[model samples]
Target: MALWGGRFEKGVDAFTQEFGASLEDDKAMAQQDIRGSIAHATMLAKQGIISQEDCDAIVSGLKDISEQIADGTFEYDVNDEDIHMAVEKTLTNNIGKPGARLHTGRSRNDQVATDIRLYAKDLTRELLEGNVELRRTFIDVAEKNFGVVMPGYTHLQHAQPVLFSHHMLAYFWMFTRDYVRLTAAYEAADANPLGSAALAGTTYPLDRAYTTELLGFDHAIPNSMDAVSDRDYLLDLEYACAVSMMHLSRLCEEIVLWSSTEFGFITLSDSYSTGSSIMPQKKNPDFAELTRGKTGRVYGDLMALLTTMKSLPLAYNKDLQECKEGPADAAKTLLDCMAIASGMLSTMTVNADTMLDQAHKGFTAATDVADYLAKKGMPFREAHEVVGKLVLYCEKHNKGLEDLTADEFRSASPLFEDDIAQDLDPEGIARARTTYGGTGHDAVRAQLKEAKAALAADEAALPKAPESK
Candidate 1:
């Protein structure tokens, strides 16, 4: 059932057949292949390159094959070089001459190029949907824990008090950027490449435009050689996935640290946790660790294709076959990791008391104490040194800034007042940050409103799928 070896006296050797086959990777694109064939056959008939009778037969046979592939009844052969050959050989065997005519204005090179674009369009949309859901989940988590206080860190040292809602919304914005990147990847994959026809334009009056519209692409690719060889869309997808995974890994790293006894800031749900075999008390955040580790894996996928395409001469090579697996793996892995993240987030317990207790330690409100003195007409630099001496005195005496008497505060600076105690309260300090995008309660609520609006707009901007396969 080999389709392109009519001139050869004998077939490839058995080992070579297995070694060269892409059935495992190509199987996922079976429906995309059928859809492209239908569009090509329809265009052939429209331009009078093939009879309408042949076009109808080809469409009908392709629809049946699509059903068979979907229903798990299609027989796949190991020696079928790729999915394009697999579908074409089956169609020719089942529907005879019209199926043979389906390849009139195309090559496997351009066919697979088109298939990858179609697959990318679909995959990108799916990833976008998951991305929106995860952002929404973070928003929900933030609103649920609104006004809860936590210690913000610089270099893992508590630097200021911030609302927990503000921290979660930080991730919402990170994923918002990821949504933009994924949208660009979809746009890159939206161009059609069907009529490239190997490396040169075909002699037939092949209507690439009609197929482009029929297959729901933005436009036909302008050059045959670039159309057949360009895999930049896959690179875009892999890059998006890699960056998104990096963001996810950062968040998961925090979760891993937060769930530990030293932090006790949060606890993961048992559903997303794993138990130690012998140590009964162990509830390991294995999934979070896996997501962090897989960020490098997605990076490898992007780099592998980049290395493969680096030295090749233009216009399709066997090395181009290495492109599909990386984008596919990275996209699927990113989607799965996002879902896991959302699940862990929605189910995990927030230790509010522990977080607030920790918020009070490390002199988390020290910045606000300096701000108070500065607002009371002291130079910021002088106020900073005054607070520094007070902090040292407290460290020696094993006391907090709040534990100092009013006279003791006045001895350091005449600007100190009894109301300075309010500045040292972590909750009040966090709420006092009223600037835009700050950690104040009002500021976070406004930020949450903007996040919801952004999510809604991006989801609406997603491309509408055509009704066909």
Candidate 2:
């Protein structure tokens, strides 16, 4: 029988019963549902809404069910509409009348809200820790490859020379912003909604704050109507996941390019790579490509929930049932992607000599040459035109900018001197970027220091992570 079947004359049709069931997704929150019930039972007894004997029985029954759930021995019937119904029916059958009393002054509307908030709290914590580890990997890679210079690109064209370490650490800041967004999502889920009871506040003298303390929530939600209806926290979490995936996709796109024969900047480790089925020589970066493709999946998860909650009325509705699966999928996907990225990057071999060789091509030293003419008392705009004409001369002669002699340089602007070769050196061009946050060696080291400090602060703010396999 359905939990709310007392008002209906007949049972629901079998197909509709099966179609409306949510046990598949709700099963993931079995422990959360049990925990919220225990807190509510204890609070009800304190407020004299239920006798002490009933409260004791409810707590004992719930704890035992929790054990059954942990060991995978608990049975879930196909007819069970949700985890709440499965648990309540079992509790009533075992402990009889007191078990029936477990739902006193409560509703599935508020109960499910509390369960999702608790579940989101745990999920966000693990994501924050995963973020910390991924950021640590970036710092490790940067410090290990500190002195190597590579081409820096604008519009995929080499525009300047930059330290490889600086390039890697640029991603560290993108993910640091992700950490902040996830933390906001966690805070949004920290409010307790248990005592809101369906849609209106309960009339049975329930102590909402007492339950909040028992459940470790920041506070009881002040507005009862808002408590059972809103799923904004889930949206926040899914949005955070989407943004993090976008950042991962960008890094993976670069990995695909760098591992190609055309660029030859890095090589994937065999364990993180795969072989093409028909081509024995093909060592494809399939994992990176997969991560990039899954980015759209997470974005879809975010949009699904946004569309679900867009026009719902002012109180609880069945539409809220559509909220759970999306955020849960997003968080798990992000955590798994972070783990894969850490392993893939940590094992890959960086081809430093090849990167430096490529850095010297494409007239990457052109900006430094232009600066040279400007520093020699020429207006910068006129110096830009002088450099443009010089590049054309090199193209006409089939030579590079570095291959031009001082006589050839002075032909464009008399400001050019024989000693300009130092400015034209690729490494010197990279080292000349000594400003804060620039790609110079010293600047990159300073960024590493600042990044480490930020990472340590974020780690300290989180609970100690559980040991991982």
lDDT of each: 0.92, 0.92
- For model 1, how does the per-residue alpha-carbon lDDT over 189-211 read when each residue is reduced to its tens digit? 99999999899979999988888
Q: Each model's TM-score, in the order given?
A: 0.98, 0.97
Error of 1 at 370 (Å): 1.2
Cα error, candidate 2, residue 375 (Å): 1.3
Regions of model 2 farther than 4 Å from truth: 463-469
Q: Write the per-residue lDDT of candidate 2 for residues 1-469, one digit (tens) a residue.
A: 7989999999989999988888999988998899899999999899898999999999999988989999999988888999999999999988999999999999999999999998898899999999999999999999999899899999999999999999999999999999999999998998999989889887789988888888888888999899999899999999999999999999999999999999999999998899987999999999999999999999999999999898999899898898999999999999999999999999999999999999988889888888998888888898888898888888899988889988999888788888888987778899989999999888888999999999999999985322111
Looking at candidate 1, the ten consecutive residues that score lowest on lDDT are 460-469
Q: Candidate 2's error at 209, in angstroms?
A: 0.7
Candidate 1 global TM-score? 0.98
